[model samples]
Target: MHGLFRFLALSAALMLGFSALASAEPRVRVETTLGSFVIELNPQRAPLTVASFLEYVKAGHYTNTVFHRVIGNFVVQGGGYDTSYVEKPTRSGIPNESGNGLSNRRGTVGLARTGEAHSGTAQFYVNLVDNAALDPQPSRWGYTVFGQVVEGMNVVDDIGAVATGNVGPFDRDAPLQPIIIKRVEVLQ
Candidate 1:
């Protein structure tokens, strides 16, 4: 009877541990000169987005990249530039996973792409408002929404509220003072 009780206790403990680990959403600590924001990535819903982001995280690709664009009502974009504002030639683009049922809402993170449907590289963005139009709908191609800010919505809002300018040739939502992603650390 004692052995059975011990076995049950062990089983219960193991179950609880596994549950915590599985439900404990993995967060990415984005350290910037401005501040640090720990953003959680949801792999269960956004597998491709989470996998792509983890790939970059493992390779340390986001270090020193600038948050190039910041539209107040849209998103604060990043993971594409150096300290001098020269953009990096990113890894080959990933496919559009926008059909994954996630919506682009305030504090949610998603990939940044060109006009092409599958042109998203290392660059990503954080929506400042509930951009429902950007979300996947029956008639439109949507930007993939992978994760939301588990913490640090304030930092995202601060980044969204920064002054922006067209530095050289690019216009529209360019940050006057560049915000650098100093590093990204994954915490599971």
Candidate 2:
């Protein structure tokens, strides 16, 4: 009787552990003018980046922001500029987590930064193709990919196909008609 009780308790604990692992990932829904998509964030791999992104989402930073940069067959960058081409304020930069084993594959979401490493804050881009060049190398840091679009990738593709040219402060690749981010919400 004692042996059977111990086995039952261990099985129950293992089942609970497996269930926790299954639901460990958090998801967010991004509503854009074109459409909506869901992103599954990999906090286990890029904890800091995911946390920072969630902070921005909860603070309503992405609302009304335009997808300012759209390059066909390349990437669609946004989460910074407003409709009037004004840059929104952001918190301090998060450390680069590019080496966390996530690649810049198509539909993967990555933090967009300048030349400086560890300079990512709020701005993100979705790769339209497998951008192996954006991955980390032996001597250089790469863009951190913390999440991937799991649904409505067609909407992202549509945004990528928009007409782009020099607009406002951008020299080129700015969408002729702004692709606005309507809202971003965390999923329970």
Backbone clashes in model 1, listed as residue pairs: none
Model 2 lDDT-worst window of ten = 21-30
- lDDT for each of the candidates? 0.85, 0.95
Summarize candidate 2's per-residue lDDT along 92-135 as a digit string, tens digits.
Answer: 89899999999999999999999999999999999999998999
Q: What is the lDDT of residue 70 in candidate 1?
A: 87
lDDT over C-alpha atoms for residue 60 of model 2 = 97
The clash number for model 1 is 0
Stretches of candidate 1 off by over 4 Å are none
Q: After superposition, how far is residue 178 of candidate 1 from its true place, in Å?
A: 1.6
How good is model 2 by TM-score? 0.91
As a whole number from 0 to 100, the lDDT of residue 188 in candidate 2 is: 81
Please provide the root mean square deviation of candidate 2 (C-alpha atoms, Å): 2.4
Pairs of residues clashing in candidate 2: none
Candidate 1 residues 1-188, lDDT tens each?
99999999999999999999878878899988788888888888878778888899889989998888888978898898877778876678888899887889888899888878788878889999999888767876789888888778888889989998786445867788778889999975
